[model samples]
Target: MEDIVFLYRLVPGHVHHSYGLHCALLAGVPDEIIKRAEVVLDAVSKNNCVERLCNENISAQDDEYKNAMEKLLTFDIDSGDLNLFFEEIFSSS
Candidate 1:
């Protein structure tokens, strides 16, 4: 993951967010569940998600968010979706 991020930086004109999206997509996350999935990742381990986000200074584009999202949804699909966190995330901020 760190390697992926470093490469993203070395390459100019690349939006770092793309890396997140790539990750999400490869992890098999669905587009709809992204926000909740992000919230979950934000709450739990700050390792993969935050490190990449901060190191790259990237806020996800739809593509990158989706990428990170796919990873988020892979196993925790049911829990990661809006049906579970919609109210909490959107409602709070």
Candidate 2:
């Protein structure tokens, strides 16, 4: 015998989910950015991050770096089902 699982259809605006990376892929957001997005996603999911990963591949170094890092850290990817991880990051502000 097989166990049955129930799945409900997602109603418009009723569910909060972020598939930005998936959408970015379809919208041709570029391979490097997509890969970076995946890295960021993994970091968000795991709640652990290392400086080296964020420091290496980014092309800009000034305000872009600061802003990007801030936005990247604040993004809530857990979809209301999990707790977000917090940590001290590199910031002058």
Candidate 3:
């Protein structure tokens, strides 16, 4: 939960707020699952930061820019049925 809150603070206004809420809900899961989700979120965050930096420093048409973006596009956060997980947690409580 602490990790999720910390990550939420780093989110930009342009990004959807639901991701932060999702992360907060994810915090209630097992430690192993939370750790894995955290890793994925961190990677996505880092990728976004790098994309922003590249956008400022390089031409959008440049190969480097395209490659960087492609990498970001390929990132998948298939943590599986997060809604179901949340439901189980809430029902159990």
Instruction: Give the TM-score comparing model 2 with the true structure, all chains together.
Output: 0.38
Q: Kindly list the per-residue Cα lDDT of model 3 for residues 1-93, writing each as its tens digit.
A: 244244445554556334654555555666755655666667676674322333533563475556655644654448556566546444543
CA lDDT of each prediction against the hidden true structure: 0.52, 0.60, 0.53
The candidate 1 region of ten consecutive residues with least summed lDDT is 49-58
Best by lDDT: 2
lDDT of 1 at 24: 78
lDDT tens readout by residue for model 2, 1-93: 674444567666533456667777777899987987778777666777834544533445656567757766777776522222223334432
Residue ranges of candidate 3 with Cα displaced over 4 Å? 1-27, 48-93
**Candidate 2 weakest lDDT stretch, 10 residues:** 80-89
Q: Residue-wise lDDT of candidate 1 within 41-79, one digit each (tens)?
A: 564445454333332424435546665555445636545
Clashing pairs in 2: none
Report lDDT (Cα) of residue 45, candidate 3. Answer: 64
